[model samples]
Target: MEKMLSVWKTAPKAGLEVKEAPVPKIKDNEVLIKVKATSICGTDLHIYEYDPWAQKRIAKNIPYIFGHEVAGEVVEVGKGTGGISIGDHVSAETHIPCGYCYQCRTGNEHICQNVKILGVDTNGTFAQYVALPYKNAWINDKKIPHWIATAQEPLGNAVHTVFSGEVAGKTITIFGMGPIGACAVALCKAAGADKVIAIDRDEFRLGFAKEFGADVIINGATPGTDTRKEIMDATNGLGADVFLEFAGAPAAFNDGLATLRAGGRASILGVFPKPFEVDVTDGMVFKGITLTGINGRKMYDTWYKARSFLSTGKVKLEKLVTHRFKLFEIEKGMQILQKKEGMKIVLEP
Candidate 1:
């Protein structure tokens, strides 16, 4: 009777509890990974708070393991699991797409109609071991640190958003400085954006944006803060060439659109709590703006890009990992994230 420690979402409330559970068995096409590192994501925070979105989405089962960003070593490979073998370092692609779906067949597996997410739709990786399909396991370079490997999933989101439109030699404005937003700042810089402006209410995250190579950092919370004017001033009055909305706040969404040049492209990856009206005529029709709604990474393509960014040092995540906790200290980690006190927190099991 092998057992493992797991963090369980026992209720639709603001806390998670540690409990003992049997180590999961792998399916014929899956492999078992001995968890090494996992990270807290904004989605995890949403579930912890049991917000309106989470209340509507999280199933009633209530006692499922709930973490997705993870990196580990393969300890067992079931029959039919090819290529992946014992002792391989790996991370998972959270979205498990059905190979036969229309989206999957058309090269949009990241948003497959029948996709299953690791933490949200099924048992997740916030435990000593997790079993996942072999196709979802991404092999990691031994040199890549465990925490960086775990950070790749969300980092992929940033990569997807930044590359959604042309970024090279363009003026870019990023609204939000959370972990993924911070990653966007760095990615935009690395991809040769002529200017990068970062906006956030949090002073710490603003500073982080600067460190990540943002040319200008704006405090969106300050009284009389004019994001459009600041962006226009920085771009020589033409407005930003590209606008990325990673902050889900309604104000940020509106401000981001307003700050874009008439023909600028906007990539939105933020999850809004509720639908809000935007001036479609003024913001899109009249302005001729191209709006792209970004979901997760572009299946395996984004994974390759994220890996290259990390391996080539084009994007550095070591500094972003501001804190670490043991498996038992997950509650403390969640508390710190709630306070917005850290960049990335990794749980070692």
Candidate 2:
């Protein structure tokens, strides 16, 4: 009867509670990890608020541990779980795909029809211990810091979004300067984007985006400001060659589209609350814009690329980690996120 402390969602409300729970036991194909570090995610924030999307997506089961991004040391490897062993430092790919699904077989496991996300569909990493399928475990390089190691999942999202289109020698505009959006700024610059424009309502996040290598920063919340004009001015009046929408704000979506040049590419990773009206015929068809809906990392491909960037020091996230807390302090961490008072917060369990 081994007990562990966990953050549990006791109700469909705006909070989480720390309580004692049984340590997760691994299945034959799984491994048990003693979580060293985990980060708060925007998806976790959505669930914390019990928003409409969370209500619709989260299963009826309450009192489940929920957190996805994590890095930890393997303490136990279940029988038949090969390639992973005790003492391995690792992070996990949150999307646990059913390997036999059509999407998985077709090399699109990230969008597997039977995908179950960690912390969402199953018990997540917001605890002292978590059991995950061995396939989802990514062994971390010893040189990677625990916080950066835990951040790879979201960093992979930014990697997938930024590299979805040709970024080298391109003028790119990223709408939303949240953690992932800020990650995209550094990634795009490292990948050789000629100009990277970061837009967000929060100046604090904009400052971080600049620190991450954004060539231009625009406050979308500024009154009487024309975002398109600012982008056009920065892009020599030709408009941005690429637009990445990570804000999920309808206004940001429209602005990104408006500032995109004809034939430009747009990769959207943001999750919208509800469908909004968009002039698809004019904005997409006539303008010949290539729009891609990004879901998650491309199984192991994006993970490898993201790891390379982090290991080579091309992408630095140390500055993005603004706060740290122990497992019992998750509520305070969530509060900081809700108030938009911090960037990335890491929790050690």
Best by lDDT: 2
TM-score against truth, every candidate: 0.98, 0.98
Q: In candidate 2, how many clashes are counted?
A: 0
Per-residue lDDT tens digits for candidate 2, residues 26-128, read: 8999999999999999999888888888888884857699999999999999889889989999999999999998999999999999999999999999999
In model 2, the worst 10-residue window by lDDT is: 54-63
Clashes of 1: 0
Tens-digit per-residue lDDT, 229-332, candidate 1: 88778989888899999998899889889889999999999988789999899988999999999999887889898999999998898778999999889988
lDDT of each: 0.91, 0.91
Off by over 4 Å in 2: none
TM-score, cand. 2: 0.98
